[model samples]
Target: MPEILIAALSPVGHFGPLLNVARGLVDRGERVTVLSGAAHEREIRSVGATPATLPPQGDLDLDLLEPDSGREEISGIKRLNFDIVRLFVAPMPHQAKALAELLTQKRFDAILADYGFFGVLPFVLGERSARPPVLLFSTTPLMISSRDTAPAGLGLPPSTSTFGRLRNRALTLLSQKVLLRPAHKAANCQLHRFNSPELPTFLLDVGVLADRLIVPTVPEFDYPRSDLPANTRYVGMVHPSPTMRFRPPVWWQKLDGDRPVVHVTQGTVDNSDPRRLLQPTIEALADENVMVVATTGGPHVSELGFPIPHNAYVADYLPHDLLLPKVDVMVTNGGYGGVQRALSTGVPLVVAGNTEDKPEVAARVAWSGAGIDLRTGDPTAKAIRAAVREVLGDGRYLRRARELEAAYAQRDGVAEIAALIDEVIGERAVAP
Candidate 1:
């Protein structure tokens, strides 16, 4: 059996696409082992792969990932850069060592890793003899250097102005030098005992070094840039496993009346102040002719102390595939998965909250004319109401979303990704 190791950081929202890919590889007669945090063990085992647990290095909190937070008291882009380096970049050595030990025990043929796990590549791919060919997987849209696409995680516009160009150049330089370079060096140094080659930027050094770069998004949803590396290929979106089966409550039938249904969910992680947003949303649409379906994702739905309007249904989670088709508008925190789901269903969006990569995703949603990206701070009830009304009243957004949906439907994501994996295995002769 050809053995493959799949490495992921944690069991958060990003794990789904990578898990789906691993499951596909396992189904293809490859022996697959998953290296991830303890929280993900059950999820890994559910896919019929052996789970190798990494020790708890405290909790993997998303708050630590946001650059804007804590900046008011603290100043300087360099300080922010140092914080990111300390929190994320400095952990590469420990992660690389753990992954290296796991690989030695299993003697795997190749590695399939998520972008966050790119840190492990220098250790796994550096030494010619001990090293195995690698494949990189990105759950989100692949970023290209040339076109603005939607701004890499910020809402910054595409630059022609000197200041914008300088800002862009500085950010890119800082990312390459202070962040990626050090992590790559750390991993290479850890593998120096085996005479591993020095690595460059994790994306280019390992991506070019890798046999293939598998992006789990379709070309239709994201336009390909001419500057994309030769090794890169878009494999379409990996449909996530349904977390829980949803049976619409009896009151769901009442929602089928005259009003159009609007679905609102802030996704799992980025909804820290769900009540702050959800309450206002419920109140804003109370007198309106729209029916709202709000998902609190297991948090207290009544935290804002607002009365639940008769027209709104509140729940912890809703099966988006089932619910999206029935919804005319989606209000969310701009999680890529949920946004893509809504777009696939031909429903327009009202995006709020600028956490994580959300501001960038929200900007894309607005730019595409498929939705409105409301500002996170001071997102008053009036703004939510106006955005909701605009999406529902204007037919253009729906038309644009339907256009994207047609494009999405034409692409067979699963088949395309499966074919790519088959080609990779065939090229390397790695099979169980």
Candidate 2:
């Protein structure tokens, strides 16, 4: 059997999508080994992939990275910069060492990595002959620096006009030199430790150096980049495990009523505070004709610390695959996977989030004309009410979402990804 290696960071956002990829590769009869956090060993094995735990230095609690002393004083962008360096860039040496050790144990046909897994950087940046083909898949928005848009985290949309392009260039330069220079410098320092060459572009754009850069989203949802690298491939969203069974909430029958169903979530990671998005959404639609379905992601409904409205139902989580098909509008904190999953089911959105890659995901929701972007992490009840009303009242959002749904249905992304892996392995076999 041809063996394949997969590497991912410990975070759910980074590991979840790659887990699906491992499942697909396993289904295709590839002997898959997954290198990720120790917590995910069972989940990896459940997908039929052997699990290899990341080194202690590489497996970190990202939530603990937040500064407890003066967290309120740090700006969002500054916190984001700190996270990129600490969670992603700083662990490069340990990640690379673990991957290198795995390769030494046995020869693998190919390696599929989460784009944020900087451990693969040393080998990819070194010699092509030294390691097997490495393919990096973007789990979030494509962060590759481009002339058509501002730097990734800024959530700036694409602009082709002269002034817009000029603005993009200026911001790109500022981000590369000032805003993100620390991350770039840290990446180079790690590369030096590995005796690998310094990256040619911004560290986030390093996907260009991989043998193949896989973007699982459709082009309709991402900002257009004329200069996108030829190595980049869009294989659409990797579908979740086929065996995932959904047990609906007791109030699930409420969805069959005449009232429009609105689903709201803060996703799993940023759900520590109900006030962020969920509280406001519940308050916003309490009096409306809509049936509100709120998911706590992980926390219990009692943690909401408030009275549940008569029109609303709460659950720890209702799988998107089951819930989205019944939803007319989704209110979210803009996690990429949730947004794409919602769109895939022809559901429109009301997005309000600024943390992590959320702003970028929210911007895409609005730009694609599939929903409204409130552009705030903590939206007011008034704003939530208005956005929900507007989305429900408008036909355009649903139309666009349906268009994307049709597009999503046209391709089996997981199968395509497996084929792409075969292509890479075949090419490698033929190389002189």
Candidate 3:
């Protein structure tokens, strides 16, 4: 069995799935060690894998997971742009040094990393002659088409005009040039320590750096891109971490006795003001018409201190797979995992908030008409009510979500992804 090293950064959300994938690999007799933030050491160790600590860097603090801490503040767009830089450039050298040392001493047979760790690519590629193969993993949808390509999964009419295609191409180019260049430079400089040549561009650089890319989302939830290179593949969603388990309370049985249910959760990182978001939602639908199951994810729940309505059940978390099948609509803060899980269960959504990748995910949701996306800056009860009504009344959103779920059901993500990793290792072992 091959030994693999997995690198994960930031919020435990992304790390959870990767750890599960590693555990699966371990069950197959492969040895896996995870290099992650100190905050996740316990979670990684719980999966029966070894953990290596990453060197301290700006923003490594796990406290960012807390709501409204104001550790750093910027407009959503600016933050996204800055994050691209930090992921690709600013932290590359430090990450490369740590990874290179690991490779030389530990002799890892393969490397698996979250997509944000693009800086590690050069080191992996530079040592191709001596190092084992590397694979890139993504927990979100990798948009393959130009922005103008009418996003996939959204049931919107396709843009057929030449102008539309041109617009998308222009946006794509601008993002690459203005937002991605500096990040590439920073990343290239980090790799330069290993005596590697400078990268041409962020797009081309990362592309050349990765041998194979495995995205955790199924293609049905995202549009299929004909334009991507052959190395990219869409694997299914990784199961949530075993450490963070949720079981429905006994009262949940009574709550779901008869009525159609709506599962509402703001997720951990984005639930900054769950009462602000959920209280209105509860008020709008509280006539016992449909059971509303809401979770504020701990912090937000405590902050709200509001009384839970008779028809609405409030908690910190719910076993998604257990609750989703009974749910008719899922209201969330545009979390990728929650949205994907809801869709997988054939439930429609009403997504709010624009934090991080929420806007992009919201845009896709709106485009697909699988649900409604409300602006978080000024989301009113009326808007939330309207979105909820549309999803429940129209029937189209639920139908589309079910269609996507059927497609996703055909593929088993965990097993297929494990097989791919095994293949990469097997091919390398026999290469000589």
Candidate 4:
């Protein structure tokens, strides 16, 4: 059996999906060891994988992955970029050292890594033939540079006209150099330390170098990219094995009511303040003819002091696998994973987010005609109400969403990814 080493950049949103990959590999009879921040050890072992700790390094503050709620959208996004480099990218030397030590202790067949896990770059780019092949897994929409897509984070709609194409190319170049400047430099510095060839473009080149770039979303949902490398693969929605731990709330029957069900969430990572989306959405639909279901992402639901509307139900968490199909529209802070879950179930979205990769996700939601983009992480109830109504009143959004659902049909992303791991490692180990 070929042992696989999986590294998630941080213990935030990135680890969960990587854990799913670990579980899939274990189910296929492979020994998988996951390395991430100290915070995720239990979750890793929960999925039946050995846990490896990313030693505490002064270079990182993983909590900074979710900002403490107070910056203008543009500035917040800029700060987020720097934090990503610090929280995940800048810690490369330490992670690489730890990984190198682990490699010294045991021989592994392949490495599976999250996109932001810059620590693996050195080993991946190393000239040594002894190194195992590495696969970069993306939990979000594919962010690589492409002829058909605008530069990520700008959230600009994909342009089709000659002028639009020129705009995309120009913006892509400018944004890549200017916005990603710190990350590019940080990545190369690590390369120098590890005696690897410096990457020309930090992540884009990483995509090029990966043995396989596996994305969780279906191809139809993403902007077309004819130039996407042969190593890149679209494995649709690598959803985790559902524990069914989240029971429906007492008011769960509200979903079966006459009103359309609108599910609003800020997801887990950035949901520190419910006002970000939950409160606003509940308030927005307080008087609407819709049933509002809000999840606090955990036990914090009881701490919400604001009065919930009569037509709404609030819970600590709800299983998206079970809840999404019943939702007519999802108002979210544009978490890419949650958005994809909503899209897979043919639920339209009203996306409101700006920090991290959310603006890009929101942009795609609008571009796909699957929903409205409120354009800021801190949208008001008025803004949310308007977007929610737009998604609900229009048949176009529903139609487009169902089209994506059709496109997602029959694609088992996790199994394919597991098989791809086998292919890369040449283990050919069938799942027992």
Q: Identify the runs in model 2 with alpha carbons over 4 angstroms from their true place.
A: 67-73, 243-245
Off by over 4 Å in 4: 10-12, 58-60, 65-81, 427-432
Compose the digit string of candidate 4's lDDT tens values, residues 312-377.
Answer: 988878888888878999999998889988988899999999877898899888988899998898
Give the local distance difference test score of model 2.
0.88
lDDT of 1 by residue, 1-432 (tens): 778888776745556776776787777777888877888889899988988876555223455546565644554444445444554445566667777788768777777776656456555455545566677776555554443232255565455456765776676666556644554455556556446465554433355556677766555555445456788877656676665656777786766677899888878775656655687788888999889999986677656456888888898777887788788999887888888888877889998866556776677688677899896733778999999999888999999999878767776665676566557767666433
Candidate 4: residue 6 lDDT (0-100): 90
Give the number of the best model, judged by TM-score: 2
Q: Which ten-residue region of model 2 has the weakest summed lDDT? A: 63-72
Worst ten-residue run, lDDT, model 3?
A: 151-160
Question: Which candidate model has the greater TM-score, 3 or 4?
Answer: 4
Query: How do the residues 186-215 of candidate 3 rate in per-residue lDDT, one tens digit apiece?
Result: 666666776877665454325435667887
TM-score of each: 0.84, 0.97, 0.87, 0.92
Candidate 2: tens digits of C-alpha lDDT, residues 338-362: 9999999999999999888999999
Clashing pairs in 2: 216-236
What is candidate 4's local distance difference test score?
A: 0.81
